[model samples]
Target: MRNVVLFSFILLFVLLIFCANRTTKNESSSLQSLYHHAKVTSHPGYEHIWPNIEFGWEIIVGTLIGVFGASFGSVGGVGGGGIFVPMLILIIGFDAKSATAISKCMVTGAAISTVFFNLKLRHPTLDIPMIDYDLVLLNQPVIILGISIGVVLSVVFADWMITVLLIIIFIVTSVKAFIKGLDTWKKETIVKEEFVKHLESTATSSEDVEYKYLPSCPDDEPQKKINQGTILSNIQWKKFGLLCFVWIAVLLLQIAKNYTATCSIKYWLLTLLQIPVTVGVSMYQAIGLYQGKKITVSKQDHGTHWPLHLLIVSLSCALLAGILGGLLGVGSGFVMGPLFIEFGIAPQVASATATLGMTFTASISVAQYFLLNRFPVPYALYLTIVATIAAYIGQKIIDRLVNIFQRASLIIFVLSFTILVSAIALGGVGISHMIEKIQRNEYMGFEDLCY
Candidate 1:
């Protein structure tokens, strides 16, 4: 089976190059005409879609995506689609739909490489119990369901549906961000005396403990205090309620807009995106464990009642979120990571679980996209091979600098988010000309231009 798969991929790669070249030759004139039209139409207004050379900048950008995805995935225990999809759309001139499709295709290589690297290193045990086995079984059915839905939608109304979905998602994300900012400001302004008093008492108790005592001094002398910081109470129920309400509102909006169909395709793509990101997250966790960082485990088990039910629910919700993220061109782990955290999973475990879950999501997505003909088999194969190889190299570099560069992943996430949001806002107004001109020199041929 492996040999067959490899041979099939090789044949596909050759076919993709041949087709791309043929298309370039035959369609160059038409493409040039479209470019001129794009220039004219885009002068006063911005276009959501732009054109560029597929094999030129796309390859370079795609490689960069693979590298970053591998590097961060090594550290974060999540796939790098959150980084890659946005980069592809904003930097590589792919629309969100095409970016999602290509990202799904590309992530396979990175994810596979990361997983193999982690296995080779014999990283620390997951420590989370039988969650993996449970997930493996539960996820397959949900994924199959999602793929069935996505394949139908992709064939029937992919382009139009994606455009409409993007618009709604943009508006919702903007509003959610603004609201979060406001809530943060509100929380900062409020002062809770009870919370403060609790913190003070906790601090006092922690500080009274001693780590060591001097032997030369008086034996009866008081030991020096060791200060362990206070633990704040869980967030207030009112605030939690408000947050839940906001989430529900967002969910309702999505449902009313019938965007669930978009998730069908996205869910499958998410499985592919999970590969490298999960390995990265796992590696980081293993390093933390090696350094004696405590790992948390949930006491709840998959018993016959609520515990089992909750596990199933959590896994299902995660699967759905992964799909949604893929459709949104952000990747599955970003959304899954936070959701897992919210469900009282330890942060590291949450990151790891999300990444693992995403692997399944991405695998299914890649297959669905290929089946739907959204990606040509040859191009997909070439991309997969290149990205996978690059991911292995990238992971080696990450392992060498793990201690120093783990935090860099968070910084990259923040910066990538900023760039994506900025691109969306600016692209909505057609400001690509400024970005393109500044990033690339004038008089460059179409083949040389960054989309």
Candidate 2:
């Protein structure tokens, strides 16, 4: 079965590449004369969708797509930006860059909703909040800094390059997530058997059982004297404050960067200022984790001190995730979701914590996009509200499902499936646009960030 699944993914990837190549060839042959000099309509980009607030078929269709994407994306911690960008372009009639900007808005909405839902919950077995505040502190600052770098780099890389890169990265990540889900599923099965046997032994033998191996069983354990207020009160306020500090510092620097000339001394200075704020916070957390002062409660207990290499590795993954967010116009949660699982964090905690961090970076991305005038206010607002509501609903349903099945692998599978769907959707749209440009004999090279 595993071999078959691997082969299936390989086949699907090959099929997408084949279609892209064939689509390019067919466009060349078919539209060579039909659209001489191509004169494709120069869409007024955001203005095309902005001024007209019509409740037409397109808006209706877009709302449906946004809701589904948000529901699943929120559950998977991917913020559905991968799905949102393509829907905005194909159905909603926004240009690619505009679609990317508005996609960030939807992601921000979903991430915010998911984070709110997660905050009210606790770790499956540990006496801590499900949202790992330490993990967020260690990763969020760098994720924000990485995003700053990616957003600028986004302009320099051509659209087709991003599309192709998105396809490759999403597919690879999807496969990894799926495989991790399978392993987690098997582990859950073993845990289930042990739990059942322990129950039976206690019923018949009456011998004192040590409960030595029931680590993952408390997933469905009912909360004791729990409410929204306590959930909020129990959070590590110091870490949360540091996270907000990095967020505000980066936001202010970005806002300042916009006022300066692109690539000017002041602009570069403002950009460089972001690094110290982010690095200082992450390094502080890393040192704490190393000296056993702070813990990634999702991955550690009170006495669990992390190795230096693992600390270095976490920082590296944080950097990669940050870069991925900037390149993909999505939250870094998509990467963190699976990475947390590999670090021995439960899938439930992984999804929650990743989304919490996503809330910060995605909202920041939305602010930056807005500052760039990349999205229409009306469209962004409407779609954001839609995503927000959908995310809340999704969280409720998924939480119930996890409790009922006692299988946390469900979230991992959702993460993988969403990324896979994004790969196909984004790849198709990108290839379609690339073909049209090829037929039009337009430039297909890197773009000027300053321009």
Candidate lDDT values, in order: 0.43, 0.77
Off by over 4 Å in 1: 1-58, 73-78, 86-97, 121-131, 136-140, 143-309, 312-316, 322-330, 343-349, 393-451
**Per-residue lDDT value at 180 in model 2:** 92
Per-residue lDDT of 213-324 in model 2, one digit per residue for the tens?
2222334233322312355665788888888888888888888877787878898899899989999999998899889887776676432687888888888898888987
User: Candidate 2 local accuracy as lDDT?
Assistant: 0.77
- Backbone clashes in each candidate structure, one number apiece? 21, 0
Cα lDDT for residue 440, candidate 1: 73
lDDT of 1 by residue, 235-259 (tens): 2244224323333332333233232
lDDT of 2 at 404: 65
Candidate 2 — worst ten consecutive residues by lDDT sum? 33-42
Worst 10 residues of 1 by lDDT: 223-232
Q: After the best TM-score superposition of candidate 2, give how far the Cα of residue 350 lies from its true spot, in angstroms.
A: 0.9
